[model samples]
Target: MSAADFLPRSSLSSLIDLLQQQGYRVVGPQVIDGAILYRPLQQADQLPAGIEQIQQPGQYRLIRTQGPRLFSWANGPQALKPLTFAPRETLWRSHLQADGSLRFEEVIETTEPTAVLGVRGCDLAALSLQDQHFSGDPYYQQRRDSLLLIAVDCSHPADTCFCASTGDGPDARAGYDLALVELDDGYRIRAGSPKGQSLMDNLPLDAATPEQQQQTDEQHQKACQQQRHLPAFEPSRLIHQGQHPIWDSLAEACLSCGNCTSVCPSCFCFSESEVPELDGTTSGHQRQWDSCFSEGHSYIHGHRFRPDTKSRYRQWLTHKFGSWVEQYGRSGCTGCGRCISWCPVGIDPLEALTELGREDVE
Candidate 1:
C-alpha cells in the first residue's frame, strides 16, 4: 500500500463533471425500483449514497442509513458482464435485394467511451474471465477497449459473499484503472493505470492522511470477515461425481429457472438464432445470453441431452466448479454469490458443495 490521494465527498460531483468534459459517459450504481443498478450518471448525488443492502440466500433488501459513504454495499444483481458482452445483440443482418440476390452486413453497434464507477473486485475478476473467453472477438473487444474502470473496496459484505474464499476480494487488487476506499467524509484513492494517473493529476485531491488510511484498512478487514465461503475441496472432485446422489436431492428443490447463470458474472453461455421481420425484407442473426439450465441448451438434432432438472443442475455445477478450471485455469465462480441471493428457492451452492465434501469424508 502506498500513500494515496483524498477527494472530499462534497467534491465528488466534480469528478463526474471532469469525466463528462473528457467525453466519457459515466455509469455508476443507483437505486432503481428498490434495487441497486448501474445506470448513466450526471452527478455524484445520483449515486446510491446512504444506502445499504441486506442479502441472504433467496433474499435481498435495501435500507437507508445515516452514513454518508456512497459505496457501502457489497454488490448488486448485475455486473460488468452486461456492459461489455450484451445480453442480446445482432451479429449480422441479411437484406433481400431487388435483383433476387441477398446482401449481408455485420452489425457493430457504436459504443461511447465509458467510465464505470464503484466496481467490485469479484466483478473485476469476472471481467477478466470474460475478456479471455471473448478474446479476439471484435464486438467484445470494441466495448472492452472503450472503457475505464473505477473500483471501490467493499466495506460492508453481505452474508452471501464468498469472494474471500475464492481469492477475489473485499479489496480491489488489479484490472481497475483507479481504486477507491470510502471514509466518513470522502474517499482515499489511488491509480492503477496510466489513465487513472492522468485523472488523478487533474482532480482536486490532497495527500491522504494517516487517519484516513487507517480507517480504510479497518473497513477492508470488516469486509473480509464475511460468513459465507466455498468449502475446501478440489473443484475437480465435482467433475468425477457425475452420478452422485446429491444431484437428485438438489433437483428436488431446484427451480431450473436459470437465475443462477443469469446473475453469475462469469457464465458465458449463449444461444444464436435468426430473427426475421414480419415484412421479411430483412433478418438478423442474434446472439442472446443463455443458461445451461435451459433444456434447449443441450438440445441438438431433436435430442435433449439434459432432459431433466437433475442433469441440468449437474451440468451447471460441474462446469462451474469442475471443468472450468481445465479451460480457464480457475473456477468459473468469482464467489460474488449473486446466484445464492437471487435464487427463488434459496438453493445455495456453498451448502451443496459442503454436503458433497461431507459425503466424501463419510
Candidate 2:
C-alpha cells in the first residue's frame, strides 16, 4: 500500500494488543495529576481521549474537548528523553571488606523493545537527538537499536509553540515508524517504515481514499495556522547571533529553576552519585539527570565554567541551536513548548531571541 490507507480506531486498539502479544511492551500517554505521563498500557482504553490541554506563557491546564480524538492536542510538559537516559539510576555497586579490599558489582543492561504510541512531533525530534548522542557512540548502541516509535499528527498546538518556525512542528514529519492522522470518525493510518507496515498488516483498517488524503493534508495545514505563540527567530541563523547581548536580558528575569531542563525531551545530561548500603561498608554508584541551569553542573576543582545565569542560558541555547548540528547533524530542540509554558516567569525562548534582534541575523 502507498500509506494513504485509513485505519479504524478499533483496529488501533487491536494492533496494540497484537504488538504486546508479539513481546513488545506498548507505552502511551495517560493523564496523571492533571498531566500526561507515558506508561505501559495494555489497551487503547488507557489512552487520553477527548482531552485538550490549555497551555500558555506560564501555565498548563486540562480541558474537555467536544470531539473524540487521542492525539488532538498541543505538546505536554513531559518529554520522552528520560525513558532512554533514565532520570536517576544506579550504575554499579561497590564494597569495602574487612580485609580492605574493594569489590565492584556489575551493571545489568536493559534489553527491552518498546512501542511508543501517541508521540508528538517535537518528542519525535527529541528522540532523534537522543539517538544521535547515544547511538552515535558505541556506548549506547544496544539501547538505541531496540526501541520502536509510533508518532501521531498534532491537530492542535499550544499558545507557546512555534515549531512551525523551526520546521519541526505540529506534525510528525519523520523519525516515526507509524504516523497517524486523526479523522472525524476514524484515523488516517500510514506506515513510515517496515515495522509500522507490520503493525498495519496485523490490523483491519479501511484503505484511504483520495478525498481522505486531501483532508489529511488540509487538516495538517489548519493545525499549524491555529498556533499563536512562538519566537520569530530563524533557527538557521542562530549561529551568527550566538554572542549577542540578547541572552543577558532573558537571564535577568530567569530564576534558574531548571524546570525547563527537567521537562525538556532532548536534555540528556546526567550526574553520578554514590549511596551507602545499610551495612555502611557497601555503596552503589548512581547517576541522575542534571541540568545546565544547575549550580553544580559546571563545577570543577574550585570554579564553575558557567557561574552566571546569563552565560548558562546562552550556553544551553547555543548548544541546542548552533553546536548540535556539529554534534548530531540536527537541532537539539524538537520545538516542544514545555520549556515556555512551564516557566514560572513566562520565559519564552522565541520572544527572548527575537527581542535580542537575532531572529534573522543570517
Model 2 regions more than 4 Å off: 1-4, 136-142, 228-245, 358-362
For model 1, residues 204-264, the per-residue Cα lDDT tens digits are 9987888888888887877888647789666777877878888989999999999999989
Q: Which portions of model 1 show Cα errors greater than 4 Å?
A: 1-4
Q: Taking the candidates one at a time, how many backbone clashes does each contain?
A: 0, 3
TM-score of each: 0.97, 0.90
Question: lDDT tens string, model 2, 1-362?
Answer: 35536787766787788878888988889888898888899988788888888888789998877777877677667767766777777778998978999999867577698888888887877877787677654325555666788888888887777777567878788888888888876787778889888887777777787887788889988888876544555555666675677876878888998988899888888888899989988999988889899999999999999998988888788777667777887777777788888999888877666665544654
User: Candidate 1's C-alpha lDDT?
Assistant: 0.90
